[model samples]
Target: MPPIQLVVFDMAGTTVTDQHEVERCFTEAAAQTSLPVSPERILAVQGMGKRQVFQMLWAEQLGEQHPELERHVNTSYAAFRHILETHYQTQGASPTEGCLDTFAYLHKRGIAIALTTGFYRAVTDIILEKLGWLDGLNEQHVGTSDSLIQASVASDEVAEGRPAPLLIERAMHLLGVTDPKAVVNVGDTPSDLLSGQAAGVRLNLGVVNGTHSLDQLQPHPHDQLLASLAELPAVLEAL
Candidate 1:
């Protein structure tokens, strides 16, 4: 097998510690906007962009062409943003177990790390800044020379979010990774797995320590499913 050149990771649930805070935000926003979205329905779309999630849910509730659809989407999305931002600001952000160590291990092997997220740039920056991961970032190139992750791509930067390969493709381009077969994509959602699979990456891994369980991720398209990010190093070494 060819050596992996880049590892693309999902932000919130994969690398960052998310205790369903995002889902809670979505649920609360939906309730506030009278969108009538169920918790199960919200969790089902965990890896999609925030605004898109609202748009989709609202479209389902009120037909896509409904005159009020756009207004409801905007209202719910704004509420979600405010709620989410406040939660992160007060609750703080932390990396998941073994996430930093895994990053260190990859860095030692001269592999590039790129973080992709369903979040827009503002919220993404908040999380990065809270974790102090943005300290050494190079504004011109958008990655850091001495940071754990080499680059980051947000949903706002691309035309589409997860389940689409655009995020992975954008990360590869920014990180100077030319071969899709030499890339590994890891996340905790079905959309994350689909994105990697669509990108034709060598390894599409799902870690079951975040938003989804093994059962939840089992039905998705993935090469391997591990207990957590802690097991990634061994998996890569064995490759």
Candidate 2:
């Protein structure tokens, strides 16, 4: 087996601490904007880009060609951004259990680490800054080996979000990784696993400790399902 050169991780539920606050924020924003989307609907799209989530929802509710589709998408997305930004800013965020240890282990092994997120640039930066992970990244969100992480790719930066391979591909491009076989993709959602599989990565891993439970993720195609990020090092070692 080829050695893993990079590990692309999902933010929010995978690496960061999330207590369903994101879902609450989305629901509140939808209500405030009169989008009338259900909490179940919002939860279903957890790993997708925020704007695209609104776009999908509004298109479903108002019809793809509805005259007010764009307007509704814009209105609801703006509200969601505000609500999510405020929640993260005031309530703050932290690394999930074993997240830092995983980072350290990867660093010692010379495996590059990149963060891919459903969030746009602004909110992504806010969370990274709060965690002090933004220090070495340049304007493009790419950092050197000396930095905390090698790269940060926000969904807005790519042409598509989860379930699309662009985000993972972008991270590979930024990190000078040439083969999907040399990569490992880790996240807590089905879309995350789907994206990795689409990218043809070596491992498409899911962790159950986030927003999704084991039952929710079992049906999705993945190389393995972990209990949490804590088990990742052992898995990697045996690989």
Residue pair clashes in candidate 2: none
Which stretches of model 2 miss by more than 4 angstroms?
A: none
**lDDT (10s digit) by residue, model 2, range 1-239:** 67999999999999998899899999999899988887778888999999999999999988999998999999999999999999899988999889999999999999999999999999999999999999999999999999999999999999989899999999999999999999999999889999999999999999999999999999998989999899999999988
Candidate 2 weakest ten by summed lDDT: 34-43
Q: How much is the lDDT of residue 95 in candidate 1?
A: 95
Off by over 4 Å in 1: none
Q: Give the top-scoring candidate (TM-score).
A: 2
TM-score of each: 0.97, 0.99
RMSD of each: 1.1, 0.7
Q: What is the lDDT of residue 223 in candidate 2?
A: 88
Model 2 residue 175 distance off true place after TM-score fit, in angstroms: 0.5
lDDT of 2: 0.94
Winning candidate number (lDDT):
2
RMSD of 2: 0.7
Q: Alpha-carbon error at 198 in model 1, in Å?
A: 0.7
